[model samples]
Target chain A: MDINGPVESTVIEERPGRRRLPPQERRQQIIDGAVAFFAEVGFDGKTRDLAKRLGVTQSLLFNYFATKDELIEAVYEQVYLNRLAPDWPDRLTDRSTPLRDRLLAFYTEYSTLIFQYEWMRIFMSSGLSGAELNRRYLKHLGDVILRPLLGEIEFAARSGGTPTMEDIWNLHGGIVYIGIRQHIYRTPCPDDPSVAITRAVDRFLLAFGVEQG
Target chain B: MDINGPVESTVIEERPGRRRLPPQERRQQIIDGAVAFFAEVGFDGKTRDLAKRLGVTQSLLFNYFATKDELIEAVYEQVYLNRLAPDWPDRLTDRSTPLRDRLLAFYTEYSTLIFQYEWMRIFMSSGLSGAELNRRYLKHLGDVILRPLLGEIEFAARSGGTPTMEDIWNLHGGIVYIGIRQHIYRTPCPDDPSVAITRAVDRFLLAFGVEQG
Candidate 1:
């Protein structure tokens, strides 16, 4: 257990000889590096390795962010913000549209973002520790990002076919997870994913009072 | 990567002070340790680590099996075969019942097992890399398993509602991954997972043409 190892400051801090960019660019570079790292290798991938990838010293890396965990939080926040764009959500206050259709659009957009980013597996995996982690993640999601979306969704008029916000969340979460299992894990699927997703979505819409489109 | 480590012995040869046990008991012991370890730390947990936990050296631990990966696979197959006992696939063929109801019951059981067994995440996450992995996982869950249960599901009766076998495979793959995300990654859900599973089950049953109970 006590095999002597290299100091972890080298692990968390940036290495020497890397170029210094402006704060905005530097932060973005770090975020991009982090996303690729987390997506390919998961949280256990070393920060020193990340710094090396950017040709920077660990010390320089720490100058921008004190620790690896803090860097992870920042990456997560950035992704969450990108997902909760103000305009799309703000415009969702159309009470005239059916909530189910609105939510379907939202799920499509959200799922697309998750698929595009591809780092959700890492962020979401790290959140499984306990209630505290779950709550913190949710607080970030619900309070900062999803709340407005929920508000807009709620603002939509419930026709005889509209799904409630709760139902949208339920069905959306379920279906998205299903898609991840198939495409991400490459689990054996009897049907094509698009077909399965359509069916699952149809069922969710059915519960929300809409007949399948 | 080229650096050589310890030269592990390939042969299952007699070592000094080696104690012998009945083959059945020995296999059971190995399987139990594997299940416990896999449940707690997942497949990435080292076989060497498992040896330490079992109070055996690497050589002794490996005396029972050729390699670590094989040991893990053995444990997975053992747990799966043991845990998923009879009365399950029966409903798949209960032709008198609606297919949707059968599907719902299967969904319920599937969700319940993943939630109940801590090692299933390991089993599923490993399936991502290749079709062989998914094939092995799905072969056990094939039509033979479903024929009895699906008999009551009224799926065949609903010509418009029944998803083809390929459709079922895709849907199963998707849902399984989602369940693993919930299991491994702990993705946030808007509703309680159990409740969502129930809702999804109902929706699946509805699609299968079962009269919702």
Candidate 2:
């Protein structure tokens, strides 16, 4: 919850007069430390070092997380997977609103979440590790987000209907690519992200031959 | 260079009877090892571990490269910067070539070079490290490649003129995103990269109101 500097592992140790945290709180503490540590040192960072950061012994760290893989998964869950909006799938399919409005709304929220320094760094760390997490995460995005949006665009466009999967990826991937250039690779963009998102969505609509009133 | 497994640090050790490589060859060997090692474990990987992998003493490692930052710079040179085709900017602006043809020609070669497992992995690792290398690399891409292409597109389109910087980045970033999804994130992409590149170029041309006769 504290989005400050790296979680200090020495906090508990420094305060010799303090009582031990409840198990759930302690677990959350370890996860916080892991996120900051992994972001700083990367995923191949040592478990012993992580325990040291947490001011806990390696054995205690292992007791909470059976393995490094488990701890990494917790990072993915905390940072990547669980950030998805609970109602995104429903909003993505909501036919009452025009498809464009829903898209702009969804991406605005999604980008705001993903474009942070912490999120992008950890996401890149997991990716560079050759882990399956990113693949699985992108597939989830395709299934829950992209494919359904494709279906909606088809319904809305009517005569222009059923854009090829290639087009679908190009359109959607273009927006995500924008975030990556800015957030991950730190390319300077002339437009604000909101402006960039709007332009990207407009470009996609044009490229797909979706007519606007 | 052996394109297989992480460049083994034990390469010299494994060849017990082989004579030592000359100084230049030795530096190149260390650079190669750093590329492979950093690509696998990221830039935060320990110098001592890299020395162990290289079958060299830590002192020897430092002698060749004064610091880890210098080693990382060597990696950016070898894996990222040096891969840029020298004539690419010229090719991008050669007016005799049709705009679409020129665009496709450049990206196909660029993607083929950059989409390698090592290239993408090291790229993502550098970006994750919060180092300025990726930003500098992306800026080079924008300056040398994207901005020049935008000028050519404007000249070719004449009356329609150029689109905004937002559009240029969207078009260029869209194609690079495909590479990131496939090579770095391991997303399943059924189209060969060349096919995908062609499609992206076609869509960009269409979106920017560039006519292809």
Candidate 3:
């Protein structure tokens, strides 16, 4: 339960000796370390401590990223942006696929990327600390994912009026909350979340008057 | 934004003069300040700093609550446990009213209590810091609210299979996510969340084969 301790076994460990890594590999290693470090502690964690944890000299750490803010930007990209699958939007909007099927597939894939200790902890920490990462990420999610998904819902609705962005957000949020329960609150969640996700997508489609197979 | 700075105008400020308060009043006052303090700075914030903010000697603060853990327990009571409407469990099972109506009403009432800067932020911080508060609160929530709601769904179902605990969690988590969006992600949420809550409840009811009125 030590928040600052290395809790996640997935976090890349420091090499025992000074085995030389390529500049690109070293930079990625530093960003990965920063992601884990910031996830464990808040953003107020010192870079010197981060360097020590990475087993790199502070100056060498600075060589990769000039300032703490710059390092944080890389962490944001590595943790948040990098995980977003580029084809998700296309697959979500693909008219060939049934809306329920698309939603089920999308959420199943999405949960796998997000339902991690590092991702969830870092996200909660950033939001608590008033960092721009969550806001920016959510904005992007709405723009690329939720908004388009809303359009798909509207297209697929059989009757009972058009769905709004908020409805789509409701579906999205409900799915995300499963991850929150597991990672943030450390509650027991289903080993495979697909069953829950399937139910949610079915409920959402039903609400919008879409027929279920 | 300055996380440490006074962001919330609602935080009770220290009085200028040395006006003594009754033991009961002083104790409540410290709990209020501690809630705000921890919400802003997380539990790792120093007691010395908290006493300084409260305009009390550290000794005086300790007189009310002997240890930081005791002070935090008071905070958990004040911020979370105290907010639970004692009548909620009974009212949620009140089958006289339709299940959808009960859910909408319950979530509306619950959202008002939880959808605040202090409540949401403190809850997230506690979770991230590995405090037992979030875990304990969620267990209480499931027992008092979600389980009973699931039973109500099964009783009201017109046909389809009985709803499960996971289904109830979907409905609950979806409703709570509106508050999370507003407070945690600092996103623009509907000014009134009832519309969204109603939709989620209706969707849940529909999925369970309960006819909507």
What does candidate 2's lDDT look like per residue over A82-179, in tens digits? 77677999998998887888888998898888877678778777776667878888788888888888888887774433566666777666777776
Grade the docking of candidate 2.
acceptable
For candidate 3, give the DockQ.
0.55
In candidate 1, what are the lDDT values of residues B92-203, reduced to their tens digit? Answer: 5665765556666766676667654454555544543232554565566665564333344443445335555543443454445445445654554333454555555555
Clashing residue pairs, candidate 2? Answer: A9-A53, B9-B53
lDDT of 1 at B47: 79
In model 2, the Cα lDDT at residue B5 comes to: 46
- lDDT of candidate 1 at residue A174, scale 0 to 100: 54
Compare candidates 1 and 2 on TM-score and give the better one.
2
- Who wins the TM-score comparison? 3
The list of candidate 1 runs beyond 4 A from truth reads A1-27, A46-81, A86-93, A127-135, A138-170, A187-199, A211-213, B1-27, B46-70, B80-90, B124-135, B138-182, B185-199, B207-213
Q: Whole-model lDDT, candidate 1?
A: 0.57
lDDT (Cα, tens digit) per residue for candidate 2, span B36-130: 88777777789999988888877787888888788888888888657777899998888887898888889888888887777888887777665
| Best first by DockQ, ranked | 3, 2, 1
TM-score computed on alpha carbons, candidate 3: 0.85
Candidate 1's residue-wise lDDT over A95-127, tens digit each? Answer: 467555655665666555665424455544454
Return the TM-score for each candidate structure. Answer: 0.65, 0.80, 0.85
DockQ winner between candidates 1 and 3: 3
DockQ scores of the candidates: 0.15, 0.47, 0.55
lDDT of each: 0.57, 0.77, 0.85
